[model samples]
Target: MSHSRFESIGAYLPSKRVTTEELVSQLQETPEFDLERITGVKERRFRDTTPENGEDSFALALKAVQDCLSRSQYAAEDLDVIISCSITRSKDRTKMYMEPSFAGAIARTLGAREDTISFDLSNACAGMMSGVYILDRMIRSGAVKRGIVVSGEAITPIAETAVNEISSKYDLQFASLTVGDSGAAVVLDESVDESDRIHYIELTTASEFSHLCLGMPSDKTAGVALYTDNRKMHNEARFLLWTDTQRNFMEEQGLTFKDEGFDYIIHHQFGAAAIPYMNAIAEREFGHPMPPDLNVIEKYGNTSSTSHFIVLHDQLSQQSIPTGSKVLMIPAASGVVGGFLSTTISSLKV
Candidate 1:
């Protein structure tokens, strides 16, 4: 079987950035709370109704896709598959769009061939990673030669809803306040060499803990809201969530972390503090220091499925990552979904 790897990546954040202090003013009776110190998010971007850039999720997605193609070896019409995996959807950020399928809509707008397979996938913050997993399988099986897994996240509605509904600093929905609006796209194609291939993509769901976090309509607001049990969902025990399976897989395959040749680990951009914690746990599981963890949460906050790709795009643009680098993309989402993708980015055009 062949391998699949990311060919190019593109991302966009709203021009209007809101500082942590500024966002505090919008919350009700939260004067004692300090978001910047707590989450390490200095500021975050939120999309607004502006002619400069379209405010809707679809518009953001289209722009991101166009930019991704501009950097990739393929054109929009060359994509054999298009997957849209966003936590939120549409111009009306609150209403989820499933009928036309955001993937098909993007393919149509981009003038992809009629034979292009397009659809949407939802896996909480792991949506784009899940899309990548599916496309990897398709490409390796010769079902598709090239594809894109993209997301345009308008998740700030949850924060807006939280600020209005929470009366105290102890609100469970507080995590939602750390999100920003962003769009990210990745162009994936068959790997042409050993160093440019995806070694593995894995996703494991601990559905038993699913009740600890949820996204639903706010009772006091007109927008959607996210509720999370921080104590229950992000405790020391959470490290065991993925390690059990990973340990067994390592033993079964007789493969070690060093053998994987991972130079960096791009984790879910949830918060500034979370990355180190996750790395400590991962290093313990690997019996060695894991690659330096990479993050962009300080500026972009959590953009759900777009988080990993956003960080990747930023790092590459900064030349923080060089060719022939091996990377591990990890996900830590609400479904207690935890997984890792090991790939060599030496082949990614960036």
Candidate 2:
């Protein structure tokens, strides 16, 4: 049996910056709370929208994969599978694509083999983690040798919609204001030793809260929009889903949270304030002091499915997370999804 490890990592963040002040200034309704202080999102990046040389979702994913390949031991043709997990599939500027999967297009453009398995998977903000889970299972099952789990979120259009449609502080599109655009990818291959391998990866969806957040066409205008009942989505009940599931899993494995020895914990970058609160809850439930929380929401905001990898790549680039560190990644996605992925990373670099 083989274990999968994050072999290499890559990311692409747009050079364009949009400050929270600028973003909120465009809102028709004045906010009662300090958007920047509450969300800790001072600024975020926007993809280049130039018609001639724009960076759409597909383009961003391609760039990220190319970057990943540059640092990876494998070339495009060496990948056994390519998983594209973007929530937004914008290709030709604003045009969305449904046929010819983003994974398929990405693999073809990168000159991968004709038999290369390419597909798209959607699980809200947990998309990339879900891809990693699948690829890890494939590697462990002797189904595949190497694969890439990637996401390119050109998701700022929801912010544009929130700016135009928000009529009150409690509006459904309020959470849309916290999104940014980014692309991230990670190469996974068989691990040679216990120092670099996934300990366990699991996910479960709480379908009851699936309606708490949704991305759909605007109800009031002619653009894409994201509606989230922020109050319900971030409540104590929702946070408990993660703690309880993880606690039970650890118990079943005859281990305690402390036994995992996570050097750092990466939660879904949903909010700056909510993350701390969630960590507090986790500490109380697990009876252990949680690891230092890692985040990039202050600069990149929430990049949807790409948020986790973006933070990982950023920290690795700055050398904040040292090699051979045990990392715990928890996913909090819109399907009311909750899961934990524990891994010891050694060779993953950005």
Candidate 3:
């Protein structure tokens, strides 16, 4: 049975970083809301928008791919597949791209061969993981040998809209202010052994809660926007998404929290408090608490599709997470789509 593993990882954060204090200063007209206190995001990187040295999503993705390639064994033409999972494609900063696939364009720029299967996948913030899920299945089925999943999210437009248009604390677009911009890439190849291999990947959607969060152009501001019903979506029901999707699988495999022996839990970096809240809920429902939670929300904010990967990269870079560590990841997306990922790594290089 052929399985896949993340052979290498890469991430790119723009040089322009905005502290929560700076963000607050930008919205001086609006009443104060302690952003850091609310979302646990002290600062977040933003793609340079300066004309002389700015980067579109495509450029950011390219840089991330270069970073990935530097740490990988494969060259440009060696990849069997290249998946682009960015939610935003800033072709010219005025429009989001959709005609030719961003993945295809990225591959072309990278000098990848024509034989490479280049495509794009979007599933809200679950976009990158969705690509991982597909590539994992393909590798297991012997349809492909190597692949790369990458994403570049320039989500600050929504934050710009929210800062200028928000009139009161009750505005639905409050969540938009917490997002940042970043690019991430992961290289996957057929596994040689148990170490550094992906164990499980799946995505479950609760469409019933789909209406709770939305991203669109702002009616009041010039930039894009996001509106979220925090009261309804963050309640007990949304947190139950993981359990509802996994009960059957867990029953069949006789897997419990303690039984899985996950050394660390890296949930989507939506917010610092939300993860701990999830841990408490899991303990109440599953009869065992989750493992120690790893996060980077304090510095990186929510990089959307790149959230979990950012945490992985940060931990691995610092050597805080040793090889053979049993890692469990949960992805949180606005479509109310989410799932768990398990992996063990013998060594994490970049």
Runs of candidate 1 exceeding 4 Å displacement:
31-33, 50-54, 92-95
Query: C-alpha displacement of 229 in model 3, angstroms?
Result: 1.2
Higher-scoring candidate on TM-score, 1 or 2: 2
For residues 1-350, what per-residue lDDT tens digits would candidate 3 score against the true structure? 88889899998989888887787676635545566887899988888988777787887788888998998999989999999998888876556799699999999999999999999988888888899999999999999999899998888888888878877757887777778898899999998888778988878998999999898877776678899987787777898898666655677888876787889988888776677787888888878867888888888898998888888888889887888898988888888897888888775576
lDDT of 1 by residue, 1-350 (tens): 89998888988887989887777787777745566876888889998865654487887787788888888888888899999998788755435677889998899889999999999998999999999999999999999999999999888878888877878868888888899998999989998887887888889998888999899887676778899987687766775776666766777889887777678988788766656776788778778788787888888888888989999999998889989899988888888898878888885555
- Per-candidate local distance difference test: 0.84, 0.91, 0.84
The candidate 3 region of ten consecutive residues with least summed lDDT is 26-35
- For lDDT, the strongest prediction is 2
Candidate 1 similarity to native, TM-score: 0.95
- Full candidate order by TM-score, most accurate first: 2, 3, 1
- Candidate 2's C-alpha runs over 4 A off are none
TM-score of each: 0.95, 0.98, 0.96
Residue lDDT tens for model 2, 206-236: 8999999988999889989998988888889
